[model samples]
Target: MFVSRKSIWGHTGKVMALALTLALNGACGDDDDDEGGGDNKPGDSVKVTGKVTYDFVPAVYSTATRAGTLAFSQVTKKPVRGAVIQVRQGNTILSNATTDDQGNYEITYKVPSSGSLTIVALAKTTTPSIQVEDNTDGDAVWGVGTSLPSNAKTRDMHAGHGWTGGAYNAEQRFAAPFAILDSMYTAARAFMNVRPVQFPELKVNWSPNNVPGAGEKDDGNIGTSHFSPSDNEIYILGKDGVDTDEFDSHVIVHEWGHYFESNLSRSDSPGGPHGAGDVLDPRLSFGEGYGNALAAIILPESMYVDTVWSQRTGALAAFGFDAETAPSPSDDPEPGVFSESSVMRILYDLYDSGSNESAYDNVSFGLGTFYDVLTGPQKATDALTTLGSFVNGLKAQSGVNTSAVHALLAHYRVGAVTSDFGDGDTSLRAIYTPVASVPYNTNVTLTGGVEANKRQQNQYFVFTGTGRTMNISVSNLSEDVDVEVYRRGTVVAAGYLSGTSPESVTFSSQANTQYVLVVTGYKEADGVYGASVSITSP
Candidate 1:
């Protein structure tokens, strides 16, 4: 997994293999002139207005296909929404304004020089969104971008260049993509000691009130933000209010963490809504929890913050809450396979040398150790990748003592995690239904999806398969049930349906191998389902 430093640069091809998935199109309308012009007298300021759009080609990354292709014919003029813009002269700062709905900005600033003042639009400081008076002209959200110093010289004095480069760390509000790039830099900088793997130009798409796709309708009001591994694109919400995530450095880095995992390692996250405290699917627990930990690792700050801002009128330009608090693993009385908070705490503990307060966090494994396991045995294992799997892999390393790591996991009530599948946990007495194991050629009756076991309705069992064709079947007596068989964590076969008919699958399995069967509801009840297994040899 640890490629030679020189060969690591070639890893970008695998990272950018996917095409962009979303296609965004914006039609810029004619702008209305402001009535009150600036007072052009001596020492008086002039009103300046400009438009902001990305002057680059848009590429597509597809999640379904895990491929990326250039959308050469597609329009590239993407209007940045809710970005703060400012006007400055020399060392003196003037007025600031947020882009309006149409990516246009107007700021009134006093003249700085005596003869001619060269006013420059600095990205991200303080700003205000546009105003709508009657409804004569169409409304559009303003796009923000920071002009680099090299690009700053291209600004037109007379006509005023519509765009320029001026990216600064503090000016993330003006250039949201800069924050994402900065997050990548922070992550890459840490790995620079070993010469980190190279990555392609990650395509990022952002706008107000839009999902990943061009015309995909958002059912929920909460804006969607994600990084498509197949597409190699990080989609962000530039919308106003609680939906914005660009300025939230933690949120940006968290999404980028997924990109890193999918490229540099492997992530088996089933992909769903996973909160820090929620009892989640094991896959979701590790995926979301790992991301949360990476954000803190990259920033190394006391707290992780996710912010939401207002595009319209308000005293507060943006408001945010912390993503991480002090390590409180004991707060969650019932920590299980679903707790991302526990996963994050364990990961942070493994890598952190500074957090010496907690006995659980006494080990200082460092990020290199974390990276080694993630890219090595954790990835090679066929077992269900979870917190337990990560711990198991970490212990297998040469330098680390397995007992010390197990002590840390036990301190957090993670249980005696022996393997990746969490084989020894007995906490299911109050949570999940009792698991019933059936030998080959045996039948077992299982009930799932009952209201009492909503979160833990899925039933799991183990079957020993000799070197032969193994047939596993599930028949719903009165309810609909589905079945999935796993050799370790790899799904060998799965069936899902909505009827009472039996769903079955047969596949050739290895000799004396342990196979896991998972039975759950399809769309209806999984009540009183009968499951049977048969093995046929030549």
Candidate 2:
């Protein structure tokens, strides 16, 4: 049996061992480890065996897929290969084994004087050992299990233990999935209080060999983690001598938020790189800000930390920020509607219990309120969804405290929010254009771009329907633009094209219904455009 002499599971300078014994009804099928059979014999141990499997949660990620159909979550399972299993007695190691491609493992070792032996599986690699498929490929093991897919194995290990938190280690690598599971459970609990929902199994991909430029250009970037909607997979960073994200609970939960958003609700976010203080695109701001805030809400901790390590040393330890600072200072030179910092602060302040006396701590609606709006109208709003759209959905809910909600928003410099479209809102730095009104048969000309207002770049037009046919057309556009018609918060018809082209749409309308015409540039495309709306009222 090989002994473990290094610390793992994020604990620094500590030791851990697994115990196993054949005394419990010949605990292990094979009695080779405990040959003496209850007779006091030196160098006698026990054996253990089991199988490992990882959970996979399939949810939609592409905006097109999500918009075309209502996606539901479901769980799938896959066997985990090459995870390490070990047996120990008290503080001493006895035996170890490596799982096969089928995830089966059998280990035999010698106990160090014990009445009962316990066995555990270590998800890391220790050199000068056996039971591995490839020693040079970095195909080290990770914690695996046969438990319910929704539950994480790390939580099971920490059960009944008072863990005061630890540093980065191999054992901690197994804990990351559990940490994300904890966040999902918190969100599920909050939402189920009003309406029930199930979280599909999520496949977490990580390894000690994962590093910068190891895979595809966007695929393998060290210290970067993302949830790919196309494949319904979560890829985390694992750097051998540098940064690894397995122990970064906040980061793990943040990526989980994207999964939740894409599946449970609707996210029009143009996914891209963003930071806390950057003035991002409105859609990107709301999605990223929601993720950051949700991570803190799930942990309910005073601070959110992300650590980076290198060469057996912590390059950046516990580098994080306060979660309670309202109207938080940001790195962006100018803060406005597109500021994720402002959005996150506003959201946290709204959900906080108001136990403190700060002006930003007066509102206390909780996560239930937040979840309700996101799953309800906000998910179906007839506007380019943003923070304002979410706030409007909140106000539309019954039993919501309007005073507290508005007060929380106002505290963050988001002026009086009276509609879902967020029209006519003017910031201190720029004049935001009001939504154009396209009466039954009126033609309107408008100009919009990412550089026009810096924040409110997407141009919106509103019209009242009359249970007939409505035809909308856009022409004279200088750049690639798409026009979508939204009714009661869902896209009814869209004029999406591959290149620069005129856009047009025709759809049956309900009487007295309010329809929003969303004319937005594709990515960096932006320019002036003319639109005409004609209605054939019966």
Candidate 3:
């Protein structure tokens, strides 16, 4: 029961000597002494046990009203699962362990008689390889620690929210990083259930100074919580008086969904600012919609809540919506294939079991079905990944209720669910206009309200090559234009000259092979433009 450290050490000395004698007498191989035996035997160390937990503030949201607040009063302790634990005496690590699902860890280390020890729990895991770091602090890993010797052998470290009395203490926000890690773990595990995947190391950057404005990431002016495909990093907002996303599980998972798409599936979205009411490009609509739906599915909750707190007023405000329900036409405005709201509702309906208010949602294909298509056909489709491409892939699956899917699609006003490129919709132009004749020329219109990636900002064209050299050009006297040629989702050629008109590109083509041309304005120019394509014999 309560054994003295001195007595234990004495007993361990006897056992070590006996083991060393046995090894010297040919009882074990020479490698046995080097392999955690002899002087570094298990009997020479003391077993350390502990649990790592962090305080969690759950969001209080209403499914009916689609709004909620951070329930600070209902704060609870959640296990810091799959996180690294280290026992250190000063700067030297004596032992290391990983917390189990229940936050329990066991480590063996030779306890020194004089020096004090500390237990540090890091917000990191090696299996899936994820780490949360403080951007303001030289990108140091976030962690919490407790004096191990002071707490005796059964030491437990609990990261507090740092909320004291009516205000938050900056030094006490130790729970934020762990909370973010838990949300990522939930999302990653959900996807792993459907498909076995080896995730790359993901670094999540967070800081108390991180606010809503574009600036240097190291200084913490991160603009907003977003996943950067270029750097493959996630920046989270943690401005104390403005906004903090530590408790916004949906928001965290939503950003993680983007990471999932980039690594596991495919995303052709022209990254930009988009919202529910905006008329976005079909690619952006589908990408954003899938993110929202994936978060809801991973959370296994229809309501998506983002809570914000004001320190001065001590008030909490939140705004969200039920991903399971379709928004009103007035709220969504353009509810169709180009609307993110429509895409989110359609995707959620496809995966969810049933909804009491949704009359048209009579199908539940489950997460496995959704994952299969997202990772398989949708990733390889020649056309941009849009609602049309996703639905077309779903319909191809055996035993899928196509009629029920059609009803959901019709409810969203997305027209027909036939082809990857919107085929049967007359209201929308053909996704790729065809250049049937050589020396083909046409006038195209680009009209939008200064938004760079809206539906009306760009136009697409297709052509069949005849084993000859081809010249493509776009002319706009008053506006800067750009052109790009693609074959099977890969760019063959592009013209992106700045402050210039009549941009052109040339390339040799193979016979009977189809190529797509995308023409757009520089900085979203709004005017009529002329485009021409001609073929010459090699």
Candidate 4:
């Protein structure tokens, strides 16, 4: 895997030539207020307060769909009943029914598109589904490959949950996500020397309420945040992808892998570009490949298919981790669980080699050059274990989690990239003054140097306590390194980006613990430049 950072494109010609066959169920949604040409500008959100009708179609493309309907009498909490309704799709109408005094209503929405579709119950007044997603959500659940469940609430889905980020430490208790921060920080230390990634803060989500057929993100569930120029909520999907317990818990850690690398700007690099002869970014690919592989390495017993197969009889003994090892169950999903072609096999091979390529399976192979940059943690990233820690230090030092993986690779731990990786943490990165101290309520601005001519980027810091609202000046700066601060990761305040250099970015802490400062990168024609971090919080 390490030999002069070989040219990745040389093998670009082999589009489908995967070293392993475990890549599974290869992997959208919309809101239409109104379709128009010069159109009636539909309100950002229309209050469809009237009775809305719908039907549930059996398949995405099936014509013979079932029809049903519910009528709503009131929209507010206290209920009203006795109303009629009908399901409609374009010119087609499915049914007309009445509500039975209890205000309970129902109607199926025809499969409008291949993505997640919402079915709203519109009436004079009603409690419509906030947003209902189709069955095709989690790969494992969607692939149940069976009839639809009669009701949504009663069903259970499984997903990985035991994960604790770059640090393979501790048991996860979903109720309090912040509990994992210490272990995650430790992992960041170990990760700094090797891979390049940023650790924002540690958070967890036990159940990702709704996601199926694969589009669901394990990025992080809703618990806490560090910074944001965008969204700051971490999302974690539950066991079976349904956000529930009771199913095999294999998916928990795999998604945590996503959250691990997804802390900054971009979550992954490009896959080999199609026809256009473009090369995919490896930064993006490594997380998925590595996360899945990492999950397998840490999975607890009770979860393995072999465990189940073996208990039933020696028959399942044949099925193990790969085709060469595992015993396949007839009930197992496609691509037999124990084959050399399994995800288990590819992940094992990649880790066994200690970042060596001949051993790099399908996913990691795609992450090429990105593998080189931060062989360890530095000033920017959160520290982690061994290789994991080195990568953390590199991120914390470089301080621009927003840059593309390739751009971060350019740093060599001399810098770190800050990115929210769309964890919805828009303020994921920010710049700070590294000041020795600051006055409690004084509005102080700080200045720091970013590499010359590097792409524009920002960093965030927070100051919260009694009644201290910090004012920031971004109008003038030594350079255009993006910087700001947040309260609960919300963009309610500002700091360095305003242009006035002062003692420090000022803010008061509500809890008076430690406020976070983040720095991120932006895409410029050449690429991204590194940003630094500093702060003034008391």
Q: Pick the candidate with the highest TM-score.
A: 3
Arranged by lDDT with the best first, the candidates are 3, 2, 1, 4
How does residue 168 of candidate 4 score in lDDT?
14
Which portions of model 4 show Cα errors greater than 4 Å? 1-256, 259-293, 296-433, 439-467, 476-508, 519-538
lDDT of 4 at 112: 31
Q: Candidate 3: global Cα-lDDT?
A: 0.75
Find the 10 residues in a row with the least total lDDT in model 4.
139-148
Task: State candidate 4's TM-score.
Answer: 0.25
Query: How many pairs in model 1 have backbone atoms within 3 A of each other, for residues 3 or more apart or on separate chains, i.e. clashes?
Result: 28
Clashes of 4: 166
* Whole-model lDDT values for every prediction: 0.50, 0.53, 0.75, 0.27
Error of 3 at 506 (Å): 4.3
Residue by residue across 341-369, what tens digits does model 4's lDDT show?
22233334323323433321222221222
What lDDT, from 0 to 1, does candidate 2 have?
A: 0.53
Residue-by-residue lDDT tens digits, candidate 2, 1-538? 1112222333311213111111222322233432333443446444445554443322222222211111113333433344455554443445667656565667666534434444554443222121111111222223322111111111112211111233334432333343333344444444555656665544445655556444442334433667766655566666534655554556667787887777778777757667666556677788877877887787666345565553445333334554556322333344546788777777777777745647645666767778788888778876656887888888887777777777667666676577766742455212223333433455454455444223444555667776777777664445556676777546798887756666767888886777766665544545555555343334
Candidate 1: what lDDT?
A: 0.50
How far residue 143's Cα lies from its native spot in candidate 2, in Å, is 2.7
Please report the candidate that would top lDDT against the real structure.
3
